[model samples]
Target: SYKPNIAFYEAHGLKGWQALEKTIAYLNEKCPDHFTIADAKRGDIGNTSSRYAKAFFEELNFDSITVAPYMGKDSIEPFLEYENKHTILLALTSNVGAFDYQTKMIGDQMLYQKVIDISKEWKNSRNLMYVIGATKAEYLADVRKIIPDSFLLVPGVGAQGGSLEKVCEFGMNDQVGLLVNSSRGILYASNGRDFAEAAAKKARELHVQMKKILINY
Candidate 1:
């Protein structure tokens, strides 16, 4: 799976948009079998959400998109309407700022748990997934309890100091429903002439570790 966070591209202005388009096109041409995620973290009102859904799933042709669930079901339902596409909701993110609201206790359960529990009742939730940070890998056990079979997109593996072994131990389901992402760790592996080679080497290391973890599962 390849997840290109839109922010990285958008930061470069027009060239960023061009690069993003070309990247997606290249992925489609070279590896159509691989899942592509647009890490946009978008969530808006019904009308605007519909357009965002069309832009990513229809126009951009990404297999899935990361969406913020703060606006409630009305904002997210538009994305869920797409049968073949996936809507990955932000739950426990891999950033320091997540401590602000996501972890606050709402009675016996944390806020993120409430988001997961309530989202489970949303229509067409079978196509739903959650973003749980690898930085908080220990919480995976608790997250699995809310939605045992749902897929989880875990970022913060490399540059963010997340442990893949810890994530796999508690986050992996019978279906192996976890996508551990390493962006800067792989992208910026080298700034010299051998950047691509260095990136490949970094990716291979993660792949090897993942394979080892999968063996135990």
Candidate 2:
């Protein structure tokens, strides 16, 4: 799967958007079997969210998109309305600032737990996936108790100090439900003419490690 975080493209204005569109188009045409995530972290009021949903799922034709769950069910429903698409909610992020709220105990459950638990009751909740950072792999077991069957997008491996072994150990469901994205490490794998080859080398390294882990499972 290729996750192109729109922020990286949007920083360049119109050309950035065009680049993103062309990128997605190329992927859809050449790598149709691969999943594409519009890592836009969007969630707003109902009407506004509908447009956002269309912009990614229809306009850009992404299979999935990351979203912020801070706005509650109504804000998320617009995205969920899509039949075959996925709405990946922000659960426990890999960032340092996550401790500010996500892990806080709230009436016997953490805030992220509350978000996950409540989300299950929403319309089309079956389409909901989640973001569980690799850096927070220790907490993944507890998260699994709530959404064991749901797919998780696990970032923070490589440059972010997250151990792939730890993430796979605690977060893997029977379906092998994890998408470990290693953008920075792969992108900057080399700063010379061998850059593309180096990035592929890094990705193959992760793939080999993952295959080894799954073999024991």
Q: What is the C-alpha local distance difference test score of each model?
A: 0.96, 0.95
Please list all clashing residue pairs in model 2, or write none if there are none: none
lDDT of 2 by residue, 66-123 (tens): 9999999999999999999999999999999899999999898999999999999999
The residue-by-residue lDDT of candidate 1 on 18-97, one tens digit each, is 99999999999999999999999999999999999998999889999999989999999999999989999999999999
**Best candidate per lDDT, number?**
1
TM-score for each candidate, following the candidate numbering: 0.97, 0.98
lDDT of 1: 0.96
**Can you tell me which runs of candidate 2 are displaced by over 4 Å?**
none
Question: RMSD, model 2, all Cα superposed?
Answer: 0.7
